[model samples]
Target: MSHKEALPKAAFQYGVKMADGRKTRRTGVGKRDDKAKLDRELQKINQIIARRKAEAADGGGVGTPDYKRPRY
Candidate 1:
């Protein structure tokens, strides 16, 4: 009979337990992708905050109401 090669193990393995008693798996995949995605999200949030601050400084913020309009 011909010899067979051993199968490789799984890329991910059981890691740790969660606070709710659930099991978790740890993997080395997609870490860089996740970091890139988080960085992009943070950049977008920062840009929006900066734009809002600039608008507030220019007195054109949404919180500023038109004084010419009569209040009900």
Candidate 2:
């Protein structure tokens, strides 16, 4: 299933940790938008995600990996 068709909300969040000990986050909302509008928002989110992925791959601002603690 396509993302837009599967997920009701188009908004998404992304975060990056700077090498200098700071964290940055990106988020958005299109809660009241119709399907077409939501699709556009999703496309925007996808594009931003792609760009961030490229930047991370290039080792731009992505610092050390963040490991998650295991649950008991």
Candidate 3:
């Protein structure tokens, strides 16, 4: 509640781009889907999954989100 602690806290991020592509951050997509794009997306997903798995194997698993928790 204090400004001191609140200042360090970041507000809710709306469109944050993670390791995944734009689909992971926002919905909808533009035209242009070909063999190259499909292969590119598959590669991206594979990379993300592999990275996450490696992180988990290293004793650092992904945190669980509390659905019941209120959003600011």
Candidate 4:
């Protein structure tokens, strides 16, 4: 076969091999669990952001220093 014809055949075979590998890599339950964990982490991050915004609105957050008081 000519080089032009051989290259397409090799690429097609490689694509099929990769497709099969992806199918067997993860099961349905594992994918769902991963999604659930990611969702929980996202929710936690959003809650923290909201809390910080609320604190900032209320005249600065927890670690604001009092300028009127002397240091040490």
Candidate No. with top TM-score:
4
Give the runs in model 1 whose Cα sits over 4 Å from its true position: 1-29, 61-72
Cα lDDT for residue 1, model 4?
55
| Ranking according to lDDT, highest score first | 4, 1, 3, 2
What's the lDDT for candidate 4?
A: 0.72
Q: For model 2, what is the alpha-carbon lDDT of residue 2?
A: 58
The lDDT of model 3 is 0.56
Model 2 spans with C-alpha error above 4 angstroms: 1-33, 61-72
- Where model 4 places Cα greater than 4 Å from the true spot, the runs are 1-27, 61-63, 66-72
Candidate scoring better on lDDT of 1 and 3: 1
Q: Lowest-lDDT window of 10 residues in candidate 4?
A: 63-72
Q: Which candidate is the best by lDDT?
A: 4
Misplaced by over 4 Å in model 3 are: 1-33, 61-72
Question: CA lDDT, every prediction?
Answer: 0.63, 0.55, 0.56, 0.72
Question: Model 1: per-residue lDDT, tens digit, 29-72?
Answer: 47978999999999999988887677668776456577842222
TM for candidate 4 is: 0.48
Decide which is better by TM-score, 1 or 4. 4
RMSD of each: 11.4, 25.5, 24.3, 10.3
Show the colliding residue pairs in model 1.
Answer: none
- RMSD versus native structure for model 4: 10.3
